[model samples]
Target: MERIILHCDLNSFYASVELLSHPDLRQTPVAVCGDPTSRHGIILAKNEPAKRFGVQTAETIWQAKKKCPDLVLLPPHHHLYREYSRKVNDIYGQYTDLVEPFGIDESWLDVTGTLHLFGGDARALADTLRRRMRQELGLTLSVGVSFNKVFAKLGSDYKKPDATTVISPENWREIVWPLPVGDLLYVGGAARKLLGQYGVDTIGQLAACKPDMLEQLMGKMGLQLHSYANGLDADPVRSRFEKEPVKSVGNGTTFPQNLTTRDQVRQGIAMLADSVASRLRHLGLYAGGLQVTVRDPQFRDRSRQTRLSAPTHLIREVTETAMDLTEQIWKPPSPIRALTVTAIHLMEAEDTYEQVDLFGGSAATRQRSEKLEAAMDRIRGKYGSSAIAYGAAAPEKEEDPLP
Candidate 1:
């Protein structure tokens, strides 16, 4: 039997959630944006009206305002969004156990087995889910019903606001082939450009191309795209309980002022590495490698990666390695707008074994450091994140303290 997959995508999620509180602005062009004063002045999400005004997400606040002079800007309420996402997924749980969340705003559900209980009609069930979301959560979503995850996601994007689009075996080729090749799953900018060079601009064109040719051009991703374009995707929707292991853990921040000295850069890297290490410990994972990215004033980014001598979740090791990686790509006295530290090549803590050198006594030092960090974690959990921090990782205090 063919799988019955549904991809549900919340429409203008952040903006819609914000409008729930400000019902008066529902008709106005509104956008949820990051704080401009903190240098995060970008459009995170925009409502339908804002879309009509040519405002787009990830564009600067000023650029959005320039397109729509009367665009209403609201600060993001991340906690509230998370709460709603949980509630929305709870509703999905009522329908099927095979619910795989793509992100906070999107999820894929496999209703192949349970469709009979919900009237055995995929399109009807999709419509019902959409209606329930709108009535219960005061939010709208678009659902795509198809035989595979990729096509179902594309189906959801075919329509907008609160609508259901079904692409079945009988009509999938007719419905999907006419769309842009980029509309297919995993066909990113680089792949799209490569396909364009070969005159494969439409889904039909991509499907018509030989898989071997695509593999020759794009390696493995080429073959994957070919399968997706031909509606041969067999990927299953995993249940929420089947958590996928994280590939990497990272954190980044844009500094209020450009960091121009070695001390300032070290401080920034330490702060970011502290967060990365803390998260690694929480997940009971350790990093086998680390990567650091530095962005200058021109928005140009330089990145470097290095393999650790041994897997570790220690803050000192992560910070030191990240600083070394940053120094390789960056020089002191050069202004740095932002910094990111990523813990890569992760392994479960239990699966990792520490290697000790005969002369260094490093194993004993690491054991002590682990205990201290664990104690710190307990203290912060009992009190608050601000209750305790590593001395070197803590943010610098202002010269004139605020009252």
Candidate 2:
């Protein structure tokens, strides 16, 4: 039997969530943006009205304001957004057990087994889902229904705000083929440019290209794109419980001001390493390697990685290694703008045991550190994040804080 997949994408998620409180700004241009006074100023999401004026995500607030002068900027309520995401996914649980979230705002649901319980029609089910979301959550979604995940995602993108698009085996070629090759799954800018160079501008042209010929031109990705274009995608929508294992845990931040001193750089690394280690501990994972990335004032990023003697999820270990790695690549007073610490080469803590070093003292120190950090985690968990902090990792107070 052919699978039934539905991709539900919440329209302008951040902006839409903001509008729930300020409905008066619905018809006007609105955007959710970060504080410009801090270096973190950027448009996170824009509403349809703002988008109509060519406002885009990730662009600076200054650029967005220049395009849409009347754009009403609202600060993000991340906790509220997470609450809504949980509620939305709870509603999806009613339809099927096979629901995979693409992000906080979007999910792909496989309803092949339970479609008849609601209605046999995929389009009707999609419309009903959208209506329920709007009426219950004051949010809207665009849904795509198809036999496969790729086409289902494309169907969601085929329309806007609150609508459903269906791509069937019979009508897929008619509805999807003439569209640009970029419309196909995994066909990003690089792939699109390569396809264009070979006169494969449309999905039809891409589908018509011989797989072997495409492989010769673009390697493995070419073959994958050709398969997606030809509607040969058979990838299953994984159940929520079947999420992929963690490859790496990382945290990064752009500082409020350029970090010109070694102390400031150390503080940044310590802060990021603390976050990465905390997350790793929570997940019961340990890192066998550490990766650090340093971004300069020019926004050029340089990164380096080093393997650990053994896996660890301790903040002291992560921070010390990250600081050493950062020092190796960066000669301080270079004006660091941002820093990231990533825990890589992960392994389940339960599956591995800490080994005693050949020298002996290092193993006892690690054991002591683990017990101390575990207690610290419990303290922070109960008292809140600000209740505890490492002296070196503490952020310096800003002279004039953004309001």
Candidate 3:
């Protein structure tokens, strides 16, 4: 039997939530943006009115204002967003236990088992969900109903605020094949450009391509897109309760000023690595490898990764490794707009066994570092994150605070 999947996407999530409190801005052009003084002034989201004026998400505030001078900018309140997300997901749980959250504002529901209880109509159920969200939370969502997760997500994107689109086996080809190939899941900029080179601009073109040829072009991702375009996605919607293991922990930040010196770059890496290491320790995991990505002033990113001699969750070790990796891709006096430090090749603390280096005292040093950082974690847990931090990693002022 074909599985029934429904992808629910909250429309213009950040701006929509912000507008709830500013009801007077309902028909006005509105956007949610970060602080411009901090150089984090990007449009996080925009309402339909702002969209009509060509305001786009992630564009600089000045650029958006050029298009929509009347745009009302609002700051984000993440706590309220989280509260509403939980409430919305709870409502979904009332219909099916197989609820899988795709992001903070989107989810996938496998309703095949409980469709009969909800009148055996996926379209009706999707509309009901939209209605419930608006009535209960003063928010709206667009829902996509299909036989698979990928198509279901595509369906949700096919419409706008408070809408439902159904893609069935009988009509999927007609409804989906005509759309741009980039509309399919995971078809990012590089993939789209690659496909365009061969005149594969639409979903039908992608599906018509030989799978082996696609794999040759895009490796596994090319083949995956082919499957999605052909409606061959068989991936299951994992239940919310079924927690997936953590594969990696990473932290990144865009500084208010571009880093032009090695000292500034080191400080940035240390700050990010500290956060990554803390998260790894909190999860009772150790990183066997570390990756560093440096974004230049032009937004071009260069990344490098390295395997650690021994797995560790220590801040000092992670920071040192990240610095080394960053050095491989970046040099001093080159302006760095952002930096990311990722702890990869994770292993459970219990599963990780380290061998003593008989020729060196690195094992003893690691044990000491672990104890010191663990104490710092406890101090921060009780007094807050700002309570204790490495002097070298302290920011002059908080920049690009993460969500």
Candidate 4:
């Protein structure tokens, strides 16, 4: 019996979500762009028309405009993307919680357990999802149904716009073999260059090559390359909801001019500790380690972490640890660009609360903080996120804050 993994990728996800918000942009050559002026700013996604003009994603907007002069560009809005992601996940969970998100825009569904209840046909279930996405969300999806993660991911990528393909064991060779060497799942830049040097420019050639030759050229990864080149992958379908995160942390930003100084970065770190504690209480997790990251003016990135003597969920203790770690990360008076704080080595908040000495000020302070956190979570749950936030992240309603 063969296993199954169904890969579903939203076509032009960010662009599609934008089209949802601004119906007028539909059918136009729109591109979801990041700051074109920033070194990291580039095209994130775009409509088909833009792609046809050779406007590749991650290409600078200046380069994009050279390809399609009239291209309309939009900025990335993670918050909006998260909203649609939740909506899509809700839709997918209706089918199976075996669903694992591939990225913000793509997900994998293991419907092996539910295939019988849905009429015993994987293709039909995929088609239903495509149509429903079109009907309900006005979005399109490229779906692949195959025996494993490798072929399923390939199936979605193999399709054209708004299409579905099923790769069965019987037809895997014919349907997959002739594809270009670069299209094989594990064949990256180095592998392609090496395979090209060996005159293996297609999947068929790579698959037909002696296993010894592949092992010699690419080492251990070559074994995986040769296997997936012939359509095979055994990666599991992991549930994002079922598995607790190894870390529970929060971060907040308040960069004036969208950039800031070293002191401001420290304050942001403090705010992040508060936000992280709020989340730790919400998730019932505690942090055993803390790290602070800084992006300097030259785009140089640096980070440092410190382990706590004991895990903690208290805001002050985490903040103090993070600040100490920050000193190790940066020598103040340097040109700082952005800062982020992360909590790591997580344990159940219950574990921390139970393991600590029950008679100390640390325990008393933690108990008080947990109560405060519970209150904040309730308010945010009832109203909305940011219903309660660090004073640094105060809101001024904006028409285009997200765009």
lDDT of 3 at 180: 94
Error of 1 at 98 (Å): 2.2
- lDDT tens digits by residue: candidate 1, 1-403: 8899999999999999999999999999999999989988889999999999999998889999999999999999999999999999999999999999998999999999999999999999988989898899999999999999999999999999899999999999999999999998788877788899999999999999999999999888888888898989998899988988799999999999988877788788888888999999999999999999998876688889988768988888888889888989887677899999999999996778767632254777888989999998999889987778887787665232112
Q: Of the candidates numbered 1 and 4, which has the greater TM-score value?
A: 1
Give the lDDT of residue 332 in candidate 1: 65
Misplaced by over 4 Å in model 2 are 171-247, 289-309, 320-334, 350-365, 378-403
Task: Report the C-alpha displacement of residue 358, candidate 2, in angstroms.
Answer: 13
lDDT of 2 by residue, 9-52 (tens): 99999999999999989999999998877877789999999999
TM-score of 1: 0.83
lDDT of each: 0.90, 0.88, 0.89, 0.77
Please give the lDDT score for candidate 1.
0.90
In the range 312-331, model 4's lDDT, one tens digit per residue, is 77666777777777778676
lDDT of 3 by residue, 75-94 (tens): 98989889888988999999
Candidate 1: C-alpha RMSD to true structure equals 4.6
Model 1: residues >4 Å from true position, as ranges?
186-226, 296-309, 328-334, 353-372, 378-403
> Ten-residue segment with the worst summed lDDT in candidate 2?
394-403
Which candidate leads in TM-score?
3
How well does each candidate superpose onto the true structure, as a TM-score? Answer: 0.83, 0.77, 0.87, 0.63
